[model samples]
Target: MCWKKRFWFLWNARLQPPMPDASKGVGHLWNHNALKGYHYFEIKTIRSSNMKRITTLAFFACLILSISCNIYKEKKPSQVHPQLSPLEKYVAAPDTAFRYELRSTLPGKGYTTYVLYLQSQRWLSEKEVKNPLWWHWLTIVVPDEVKGGTGLLYIGEGSRKTELPTAAHPIILQSALATHTITAAVHNVPNQPVEFTDDDFGPRVEDELIAHGWRQYLDGGGTEADSKWLARLPMTKAAVRAMDAVQQFCKEKTQKEVSRFTVIGASKRGWATWTTAIADDRVVAIAPVVIDLLNVVPSFQHHWQAYGFWAPAVSDYVREGIMDRQNTAAYQRLIETVEPYTFRKRLDLPKFLINAASDQFFLPDSWQFYWNGLVGEKHLRYVPNAGHSLSGSDAIESFVAFYHAIVNNEPRPDFDWKTADGNILINTDPQFQPDSIWLWQTANRNARDFRKETIGTTWTRSPVEFSADGKYKLDIEKPAKGYAAFFVELVFVGDGPVPFKFTTGVVVRPEEMPFGDYNTTK
Candidate 1:
């Protein structure tokens, strides 16, 4: 007999002794027979005189139970490996397309945590049938520092065709000529997903690219609940997993190794962009616009306020579970674990820092503080008269300039605040005290005829003035002559005659003045 058949035969024969116990019909008989059968089976398997005697004795004992048994037991065939279902096969296939969904876990009462889905697409064409572009993944770090960190939020995407205005088309077209793709991401305090959205933010950015003739794919739907769950998750593991998923997606879709890509994040999302860059080497460039990096204090407060509605439940959960055991040391441990991976140095690709002079949440000074730390091929653009929402004309122009510089290897031009040539003069009087305040006069002298009219005829009063102490003043008149601008300096020499220095005319244009760092000399 085959080994399989023999194995089943022995199993059935052994089971026959116990089969008499149908509805407790053979309690003692089954037990007694089963014991005898075990002994007989073991002895028969051994070949010896002693074994034969033992087997004959055991067999006789079990044989006595056969007299009372009449009914036979039914047997069923066993299965090993089961057949694959249709859904299983489809999911397992490498060529199928799938949309990404976020999964989140909440570990605290006041915080949200999330696992963002990283999806990539295959490039399908007649010439390159199976060519695919790898998918790159990233995660937003809320208050990006604290352990059991909560109050993270993400916004959902809006309709591309419906939301973006016609005026934004020109800007988008310009950006497309300079960038491989147009993308955007979000960031919020831990456990708060207030403003994250793909339609309102992502599609608008993509629409700008689509207007410029590039195919676009944008997907993001981060909410407050998502943030709470993300907060409770371990930052280091999530970051590693996100990076892996992105790399795998990219490799699968492109069929080629993906070594470099860009990451773009605005507002709070800019924090995520920075964190992702620090975490992964594959990220080639990072554009973080209007980021706040002065301190974590303000962010922590903002997150609490932004996500107050969910705090009660999240807090309760944390108190009941793992959070109650945590202290400052525990939080520090988490930060230390993720800091090395999330704090990136200079990159091989372009890094753009864009901000507005009057940003509400993130001050101009904050951008200066953060960008100063960034190394490598870096560029910064500050828009005047622009607010927190940087959709203004000046801001858009600055963004376009940055994109062009990065893609085309063009250098950014220096800022200038001049139109025409004119000279400014400051009037100084000797009869002023050391601490006395005095009003000064400005002279804008436009030299009309330098050949004949020398002193009085060519002299014009340019709107510029100075104080006795040489501390503060204003330019009342704009220049309109030569390529020169001027200012007056006052040096107070006690309460007597004060020495004055008439600054040489310096030519300046509106674009030449540096923003944010006002105290360059200091």
Candidate 2:
């Protein structure tokens, strides 16, 4: 026993010079120790030392090996982990086939716009899709008075397959100058007019692409190979790569590294904004405009209940039979892969959901289905007298305000609301009292539908005042003959450039489901 103990001391002194602190990880140390331990075990002196010493030495060697292996594993990056979400896996996948070229630069009133042509990536092989190469015209608005390292990314949609870049969007430029932050807008979000097969695919740009990919995946029996071909993969990849492009381009051109971002978009682009935030950590905040159906399954079902028939706006989804197969296991898998609500736990940053009071694609009261399930700081605004397009409305002002607050690290007004008895109750932070409050209400005597096209811009506003208890309450009176929808809008006019507007979830009187449940006409 004394001789064996002496041997252990000599062996330790000779082999282990001094193990590095485990925090830096065991990289080469593991290999060196493993090989040395193996050779040491084969020595004849160890064999003659006796069974007790041999067993002790083997146990000690095993203990050291386990620690070294764990140290190496601890240092591995989370991106390489097997538990990555489908969106994360797709976006993080290495794609060296990417390039960007600065097409032109134009000077604005107080900002400079750079038009860059970006080839994001090749989605699938040419055998699968006609044009796998995804390209876009990106307009980056660098304000003369840039504030911080953070920039605003607007994921916009367009179908123009042109040789020359078109004009920059007025709203994007306005936001850049208003917020005084570096702003960028990426067009052709999915690289439109792509031919999937000999078939026309459809008239729409983004939805048709999504439906086609879903059809292929569903028809192929939901294999792993089929999942990889989802249209959302390239859509999300495009936004992620746009950030990469801007960061690199800004560094090289302006000599200012825009490291952080706040992403905004409307319709399908809004959906991409949510997924992009989940896929990339550089997104400091998000303002998803008018894509309100987050918990997709329940929200759509609620849509069916409100309007006995599916709105014509969603005909693209109906044409591809995507709406009909919403109840299947394959559809659930699809939702898990691409739906933002599936990854709700990951959306902890500030989110400002800018919606329309009468969106053609979604119901005004759709927030009830998914709002409570969301975690972290969130704000909602349903712009009155507007629809899916939000044209001729001031919704952009609210969005710009939200982005400005996030980029400047300014505290936005905090508020919450709920339905009680026959009225909607709103309680705001005492320190952050709003400048004004109004109740936007409308009634539909013929049906439960409140689509902008069906009801027009009939929503009227009435001044609302705080009660004795310091909570603003709006009386939700059920129409004697038909259904009515109402919400309280709080306009917070602070020192920011634009007034931040937010609203309580819209409440519809006579809460009744006219359509019973989701019934597909397919």
Candidate 3:
């Protein structure tokens, strides 16, 4: 219903003339000639006529008064007319939320993709759908073989196809979970269209509803472009709305409740993923890759971080410039409203943080305080010899394995690592022995001299031996380049050859800087 409303008004009122002289008992004159003087001359002509013409003018005046009163009543913004959001339609069941344009199945995959316009909450909230805009939501069903009650929702500016004609494509549905992965993606709201004249009203309001941002704006108030009350941010609102639709669709279409759910994203979307995890209890897990911005304090520092990459996100607030970037209250307010780390103590869900030691965006050490503060079953995987590529690596499989364990009521594997003395200790299962354990240098991940034929090289091993307690100790000197990453290389797990279940190579760096890799950036 919000997709069909039109907001347009005709201009036909005249402007009042300027004041003449208040001392002469004449200030201003009310003129209703539509500012073209046509009605004014017509009235003059009628006044010169006889009594019969005046009586006719009186009748017309009464009719015009009645119409004006009716129009005024209709124009008042306070009159309440409520409407349901897109997710609400699935619950209420009259197809009020969405209109499907094309629905087809992916070839050989048995997954369905739907191209449709999702009605926005702006139209739903303001009544009559006065501001209506359309965008596509690419919905992909999990493969037929793995039909289960778990749902993963991805919201990002992903790729698109001609059939769906959108920027959102399924990033995770094709992974290990695809056998039963149901996914929905909502694109960044379209650039405000050209024809929608109400720049900040209607469905367009949803995009601009978040006026820059401030701590008070989290729950939604402030003097914004509208009435001066801080505007509500649609960032988290839009995410929740789209996810609600995805879960609801999975529930109704599959005739099974999506008992387990996870929200996944990278970068800024990672921020949304964590925010979504905290806001919604149904989300059993959250995987936010490479973006670690939590209770951002003034003293926080990232030494290995390249300069000029640190731009404060809170600066987007309308009044942020009023105070300096170093202002403590400003930083605290930002943490209170937008930072998910502010409430890290209350979280009880499992979270998988896929990061890399050499990440260009966020330094691994920069995440210590925030990551440790999480009150959840947290997993921080900082891959050695890798930068941001961890997002596409074995991390994907780990996520699926984790969700599978969760939905099937099983246990997820642990990659426990601790460093002491001169060796890395790995608590093993006795039966599983790593093929080799190598200490790597971050600056040297690019070139490591080794022979191709041999799987085990003495150069790669640094006098490492296994002890009776299952801890592997390495007797090696630190690299000269100033950074070290280590991994326990296990024999490749393949069909029938390995006795491990859901096992992959485990990597970890020290809580503090490792040997030969202390911060020397000046």
TM-score of each: 0.33, 0.83, 0.57
For candidate 2, what is the lDDT? 0.76
Worst lDDT 10-window in candidate 2: 29-38
Candidate 1 per-residue lDDT, tens place, 453-492, comes to 1222222333323344433333434445421222222222
The CA lDDT at 288 in model 3 is 79
Model 3 regions more than 4 Å off: 1-107, 123-136, 158-170, 176-179, 189-233, 251-256, 298-300, 303-326, 384-395, 418-438, 444-468, 472-522
Give the Å shift of residue 412 in candidate 2: 0.5
Q: List the RMSD of every prediction in angstroms.
A: 28.6, 14.3, 19.3
**C-alpha lDDT of residue 222 in model 1:** 24
Tell me which of candidates 1 and 2 scores higher on lDDT: 2
Best by TM-score: 2
lDDT of 2 by residue, 13-76 (tens): 2333332322242111000000000011223335464977877877776567545534533442
Residue 153 deviation, candidate 2, in Å?
Answer: 0.4
